[model samples]
Target: MSNDTKARMIDAAIDALQRRGVAGMSFTEILDASGAARGAIYHHFPGGKGELVAEAATRNGQDVRAHMAALPGTTPAAIVDNFLAAVRPVVAASAGGGGCAVAAITVEPDGDALRTIADTAFTSWTTALAERLGATGVEPAEAADLATALIGLLEGAHILCRAAGTLEPFERTARAATELIRSRYPHQKQSR
Candidate 1:
């Protein structure tokens, strides 16, 4: 049950972080949301709420990687669309009422250590996208650059979508991104 409690707390933390930012994040709230005993917090995270939140941030990053991994795509352009497929439901489910957990950590005050984790998470995500591009015959350096741009557009879209409580930002980015792939990787047929 110890493991279960830890998982619950992490999941709860992620959900809370998404909707409520760090200021509203509290151990009691996490416990209530997770349905875990009070002691579970201290027992599982001796470093306190910060530790728990950091873990949740890491989990958030890993979850995105996993989601992207599960998507089907044989080319760089396909992977871009696959990324859209992976995250579209997430934004829709939140109805632009929430933000990414890792992003939340990066903006938190006095969160240097936590920010490092977020940085690593972002780097990992960028690398994964870059690898997809490279596998589709894009040069290593060019692929890395393209991946960064793509992720940047996606992140910016997330912010805009959340602020507007609509998916218009994503829709716009989708068009722009599709045009990007089509223009740059003309050899890759539009499989989607």
Candidate 2:
């Protein structure tokens, strides 16, 4: 298959994983969504759905990490706000149709390879957040802990917002997370 076809398949798989979870995704669905030829699936992903899904999940995680790393701010509050801003559109676009790909995959019993991808993605996010927090003077250990909490807050809030069919949960969690991060750096101006 051509590289375009392969990339489209990956993109389609990511969307399917985010929207429907692992059990819901199928070769037929991917083919329909991507508009790739049936032969492309085997050509691109000889290992079948598992390989394709794992690659898609890994790419999603990397995209998230890159987004976090590129957040344009020097302060924890600014960083947090930027992070929320970056995520808001995605959640809004999904409109309760789906949620974070890593979160969705983590909860499903999709075997060790997929689980490891989810774990790595979560770790990448947490590590990026922690590094940003540490740059703002939070101790390394405390920043790590807080970063993990922030990830949990955001992921849980995403699920809650999806379930409730409203953005209120995510909004509330974003505010609380900003406050928590700001609290750690009390000297910074509070303008979030």
Candidate 3:
């Protein structure tokens, strides 16, 4: 029960962070969302709201990293497609209201701890993508560059999708990213 409550709180925190960001996410909101009781906040998160948000950010990052690590193909296109597919449900579930939790948190005021957590999460994602791309025969430097660009593209697309209240941005980005990855492997026949 204790672990369940903590997990619930973390899940709620992730949702709150995605939807409302750090300043907007309140203990009351988390409590209400998680139904974990008012005292549970301090008990589960000794560092208070900041700690909760940071942990939520870390959890979200780890989830993405795990998904990327588990992606099924060795080709760049497959890797990119699988990655975009992994995040599609998240964007849809939020109704395009929220984007990457780490990206959302970065918009808030800086705190070394929060920044460090966010930076590590972002780096982990890029590194994972770069590794996948390198495995597809892309040069190390080029793979890193493409991975960085893909992140930028997806993050930007998320922002645009939220603003427009549509998934068109994400869809367009997915296609473009897949194409970009495909272009990197001119010898391999492209998959539709």
Candidate 4:
């Protein structure tokens, strides 16, 4: 039941972000929409909306890392494919309302908090893939670069695909990413 309440609050928070783009989301709105009282939210997230948003964003980042970690192989191409596969479906279903959490927070006025949250989330994600890349013989520097490039491409793909209302943008982005990986990393290509 406690877990359920937390999930509900998180869901409400994401909905608030989706509808209002973060700037307009408030504790009152989240509590009302979540059907959760202020006390309940405060109990779960005492730092209020910033805390809630940070937690929600961290959870989103964790999910992204978990999905990438679940990919079949250690190769760069395999990792990218796993990520694209997971992302395409979610983005398609969201119809663009589920924009990147980092992107959403990038608009916030406080540069320090935004930097901390974005860096933490991104570092967590990059570190996960960097581990896999190391296992596949990629150098530390190359792994970091590859991880950064893949993330940038995926974010761009998400924006373009959602804006176009078509999967073509995603497909094109995936193909280009795959080609880049293949040419640079020489991984066996898997048909998408």
lDDT tens readout by residue for model 2, 1-192: 498898999999988888898888899989998899899999999999888988899999999988777777777788778878888877764557777777767766648777888999999999998898787777899879977887887787677877888888788888888777778677887553
What is candidate 1's lDDT per residue for 52-119, written digit by digit as tens?
99999998898776665455677777878887777777766445588788888888888899989999
- TM-score of candidate 2 relative to the true fold: 0.92
Better of 2 and 3 by TM-score: 2
Best candidate, TM-score: 1
lDDT values of the candidates?
0.82, 0.82, 0.81, 0.72
Candidate 4 accuracy as TM-score: 0.82
Off by over 4 Å in 1: none
Q: How high is each candidate's TM-score?
A: 0.94, 0.92, 0.91, 0.82
Clashes of 2: 0
Query: How do the residues 64-142 of candidate 3 rate in per-residue lDDT, one tens digit apiece?
Result: 8777667766677777777788878776644557767887778676677788888998888888888887887878998
Which candidate model has the greater TM-score, 3 or 4? 3
After superposing candidate 3, which stretches have Cα over 4 Å from the reference? 93-95
The lDDT of model 3 is 0.81
RMSD of 4: 2.8
lDDT of 2 at 121: 97
Model 3 scores worst on lDDT over the 10 consecutive residues at 183-192
